[model samples]
Target: MIKCIAIDDEFLALEIIENYVSKCPFLELAGTFSSPLEALPLLNECGCDLLLLDINMPEVNGMDFLSAIPNPPLVVLTTAYPQFALAGFEAGVVDYLVKPFSFERFLKAIQKAQSRLAPRPAGGTGYLFVRSAHRMIRVDLDDILMLEGKKDYVAVHTQTQVIDTLTTLTAFQDKLPVKDFVRVHRSFIVALNKINTIERNVIYMGDKKVPVGEMFREDLLRRIG
Candidate 1:
């Protein structure tokens, strides 16, 4: 479950967030506060995974509150003002929810959070339970063709489908078996047996052409030979 704290000056807004969070199977509401300042002590104590924040708080506006933290949790900004959306992303917020958003929209934001939150550890495991929009999917290791990094999401391309799961590629680096999977580039990890060819530093997995990083190319060659 993703532990989260909600901070909004509006009591009604906080209520809605709490209600929605309670309904989701994967979320746990740690606490809620009308101001960021009031939430600070709890935020420091709990080390929550996500923050459902509002941008226009009266006490200490959400942006300022976010900047004060040296290593803030993944934040999903909830605000009535759409103008603050860009600024929120620049501040490294995971998702932005406009005020009066439907539960469906709110859930989608949580889905984004799910993608970035902890995934089940994959080492020594034959399969992984990947997070989807509505449920967790069990994917076998041999079925995986490659993993493509999509900013905060990792697209696990298999023989039949592409599963977009939460977690950065850097964070996922150590999760796979070294003998089977190799990071051919910063954005791509390919199953060694699935690659058909490597020509001019590009890897071919079926019809897909994945570029090989100069730094990782020597390792790929050594492994292939």
Candidate 2:
């Protein structure tokens, strides 16, 4: 089961999350907090698999709370504001749920979080075989520098060269190891080791500069720093 916690200042929101958790056999509700602050102690004391967080909160917001935590669990933003979606994504939130979301939408977001947190085999090389242009390509985790979106295709930037193929960013993103690679922009994903420096909204990989989206800036800073 995927252990999780729900943090929302509104009692009604918490109740809805609780009810949803009960219906999903794969999800185990560990706790529910009306205040993000109260949830911090439990998070520090015991590691959780998933966090359903709220963006707007008194004292500290979900984004700030996540920033304070050293190594946060997979987070799914639950907020009334849709504008915060990009910001939440940049903060490494596994998913985003606008308030008054249906159970179906909620389930989809949690499933994504679960996929991200799923356990990998010991000593695994973390390689993925992707079919590009009817040809199978084996990608090594360490060699990738970044990925960029080109229309409907994604350009896989590696240490040696760039490879372009028809694939959605999300499709390729799901195949990558969460710890080693990060989606720093809607159009880009960079390998952690390849990042030489971060200056404002740009990430430098050697001499190449990758633009960091506004919403992703905070998350990239946290990852690189």
Error of 2 at 28 (Å): 2.1
lDDT for each of the candidates? Answer: 0.82, 0.83
lDDT of 1 by residue, 1-225 (tens): 889999999999999998998899889999999989888899888779889999897789898888777547778899999999766654446678998999999998877767655443557447778888889999888899999999789999999999888887644544565567777787888999999988998998899999998856765786788
Give candidate 2 regions above 4 Å deviation.
121-143, 149-153, 165-171, 183-187, 193-225
Q: Which residue pairs collide in model 2, if any?
A: none
The 10-residue segment of model 2 with minimum total lDDT is 85-94
User: What's model 2's lDDT at 149?
Assistant: 80
What TM-score against the true fold does each predicted structure earn? 0.56, 0.75
What digit string (tens of lDDT, one per residue) describes model 2 on residues 1-225?
899999999999999999999999999899999888899888989879899999899868888888777778888899999998766665667788998999999999987877677665578756666667888788777778898988889988877877888887766776676777888888899888888888878888998999988866766677767
- Among these predicted structures, which one has the highest lDDT? 2
